[model samples]
Target: MSFSGWGYVWTAVMPLAVLLYYFFRKKYKDQHVASTMFWQELMKEIKASPYLKKLQHHILLYLQLAALLICVFALLGPHLTSEALEGNEFIFVVDTSATMLAGEPAAFELQQELMKEMATQTGGKPVTIVTTGANPEIVLRKEPNREALETAIDRLAVTYENAKIEQTILFAETLIDDESTVIHVFTDALDRSILANKAGMAYEIHGIDQPLQNVSMRQFGLAKTEDGIRAIVQLVNETAEPVSGKVILTDGEVEKTANIQLEAEEELLVPFEQLPDSPVWQAVLQVKDDYTADNSMAAFVQEASTRVAVDSSLHELVGAGFRSLNVEVDLMDPMQLRKAGGSPLVTNQTDLLAGQMPILLIGRNDEKTHRVAGAIETVPHALFTYAPFDGIYISEIYPPFEEYETIATIDGEPLIQLSPEGDIAVLTDIQLTDWPLHPSFPLFLWSAIGELSGTDNFFGFFQPNEQRAVALASTRGEWEIYKDGEFFYSYIEGQGAFSAPQEPGIYEVVGEGKTLKMIVQLSNEEKTLVQGTSYRIGQAEETAETAELSIVPWLLFAVVFLLLVEWEVYRRGNAHR
Candidate 1:
């Protein structure tokens, strides 16, 4: 209990003085009466009331006095505090996660105890309630009203997601201005990664003392099949100690359980056999550990299909790669020709899509039908030329060309240049015909592959990035995709196929079937973890408080209102008599 308006204490004396004056005030009497006996009766009644009936007879008097007392108290606005209520600023963060629900007295119970501590230490200091979970929420902020602050604390609940402590800290940073603020955080220690980035503001950490030993179904995957279902389950040992657990797979009445052993920080994979054909299945990883939410994963499985196309010339290699990668690739011809039915390139048109144009033309003079041969000209897509291609041995040529510069003189010539008009021609002054048999055969292969394939200049085994779809089939009816243990996406029966249009990730198509796993190797930045190992707090501020009712004032008002009603009743009774 605390007072807000202590300066009004002297005004309280006025009400007391008024009460004293009323007590000693002189009264007038009427002489005429049916009998002095009746008057005597009244006097006797007053005396009896002084003994036992006094309170009952003069309830109105008590009411009037109460109203006056309440008004004085309200004007004084006095506040009382125990030794516990002496903090400058009360800052409390409550951990609201499923893990909090597991401990002895329960996480919420522990939070209540802490809340009491905060309430006691509040005195007249403003209190703030910060809720921690997947998304941090500010339940209260700098509210000097104690009852309202306590109600907000009581309303806090736990969530299935983990706490984002760093975000809460950042939020606190913005809430507080002076360093004198006392901040208290209450939570079960989750992944320290959440705290990797923080504003340097220091605060006290009150860990809800509990050791979490959990074995969760970290991942589950399924692939669609026409006749039966196939699935894969991964169990992770989230505990510090090595633990063994049983994994059960069931579709309603049917069930299968497998025993598994996992070292600390390691995981175990349990594959499911042909399961009964069903649209949905539930898998439970039963852990001997303390917590259970992290123990099981439920997924709905469904059937789907897809198609993947691959170029013909890369069949043997692509086939092997697909088998290793577990993706089906259909062989097809290259789409680089002028038309689907057109013959391959001729000598002057070595670039597959170059048409009849030369790559490069170098002369002070200009020629008709040729685009330009200078740096100023924008060359055609397939035509890249250079001046002086007279001596070079080009072996194993995919498209024969009439003009090519010798490899030995490339330093002095344009080498392989693009003409201003978009023609691909090499300088012809150097001499060396058997360049393919030279030590640069591999380098030549790289260059030839780049020219033949209409892909970007990156000459690797994998096709240059062109958006294309790939289909995967499974004996099971559903599947999940994961990259490095983190969930990406999933597919179920009737959903068709799970298509990835992005760069690359080492994907695990976990679920039913013999083909239980596949890896997608992406060399692009879109799929890479560019920021996982690093974090920075860009902005952190204490959250602003929403408009809320202050219970202290309301409670005081209720007491005042009741007193006033009693006072009105007393005055009316005195007048009627």
Candidate 2:
């Protein structure tokens, strides 16, 4: 037992002295009775029952003295402690990673429970709670509000991001000026080197101390084939031993099952051939693992559906290239087609030149009037991914502009140029130039079609960036955002862009009869669950003081009960008299 305000303890002596003085005083009253003999007889009866009579006379005195003692003790503010807080400060580092979602109680839950226990043990000392999330944050700071600390712990939640443990530890160290202050970390066993960086720091690690052997689908993809789409799923056994599992692949209402056996630390790729036109495919692993976050994965097979309007004289090889690249081309005379983002016009027809959209003007076949000239290719382009640009020859020259980006040059002329407006790509006549026979012929066209198509630029995920600019086809009056199928917030429709959410998950932009999907995923390192690896980095020689609860409140309650008992005794005695 300890007294926080021991200076007031000496005041108890004043009340004690008063009680003694009153007890020693004489009590007398002058009264005229009917008979002195009756009074004498009553006194003799009181003496016969001395125990009951004495208690009645002394009850008030005892009550007053007990109350005075309690008041003094209360003023002193006493408490119990097994160990002293030498520095009078503690820092709690919590891990909020996807891996913390594992284990029976979950590592995050266990960390919260430990924080609650520590809060109860605190002797009004300063405490701070920090979370090692993708963006590390200090949930609670140096304050003695026990309730607030508990509330902070209750609010702690796991994130899909990996634990930025080292950065968080370094931050905690900055808050510690006293050598005796202890830093308590609540996390898994993965990273502990941060503790060792500090030569002499008082630190203790409280880990979840459990292992979760997991089978995860690291990657899932789909490739377009001649017959249909091919689905590929990659499974990894993140364990020390071999594991057996069943993979259940679902395409719409159709289902397929395959048994898999993986050796220690093995990775297996399973492919399903000839899938239907299902836009989304799901692969689930039927295995009992400690962590279930990565047990199932979703992959989409979005085939390129470019609307390429080609002239009747267009070579059959051009159509074959579009098909090989999964492009859905519409064979029609260029004169009958209207240009759009998804629709690229490919024709030598001179009648289609009067449209508003930028034209991909192809030169007339004049081998005698024009000569092949060396060409220059543009740097930093998306179309260069699948094909190499050697050079293309042009027989006829067209007007060149500084506002256009040359994709390929024809005999010192613009063979293929992207207009600064970003809606045009022009090429010279392939019949007059030997460019069609080049090895990168089909690949270049396939890539060019992707650049022209608006679908190719839709962002897959919103990560590592807070803001993004979107090119909406039509900017209407109202646009709204949805999170996990529920309406979240509204944005001005004319803004044509949206800010990324702070939390990780799938978000959707819906309005004007069109919907766009965006995903946000955390760092992959945090998703990998490596259990049973928690330990302290630095060990201090000094022993930490264990906190013990004070019984002062219970003692005060007893004093109240005693006072009530005394009140009843005095009341009953007066009634009898």
- lDDT score, candidate 1, position 496: 43
**How does each model score on lDDT?**
0.49, 0.67
Residues forming the 10-long window of minimal summed lDDT in candidate 2: 361-370
- State the TM-score for model 2: 0.64
Residue-wise lDDT of candidate 1 within 1-577, one digit each (tens)? 5566778777777767865666566667575657888989878876766445434556666666666666767665555544542235656877665566554676567767777656755555687888874346788878887678777777777654445567776776678755556566776543444555544544555565555466666666676666578889876666668887688877567988888889987867888878887544567766676555445544445212112333343315333433343434444454532332221121222344235421122121111121112122222221211111233343211211234422222323233443333333432211123332343332332222224332221111111122222232334546676655788667663364244412222245566433233322222211111111112222223422322222456547767787778867767877998
Q: What C-alpha lDDT, on a 0 to 100 scale, does residue 522 get in candidate 2?
A: 44
Which lDDT tens digits does candidate 2 get at residues 148-255? Answer: 888889988876566778888888888886666788888876456555467777777787656678778777778778988788888888888998988888864989
* Per-candidate clash tally: 53, 3
What lDDT score is found at residue 36 in candidate 1? Answer: 86
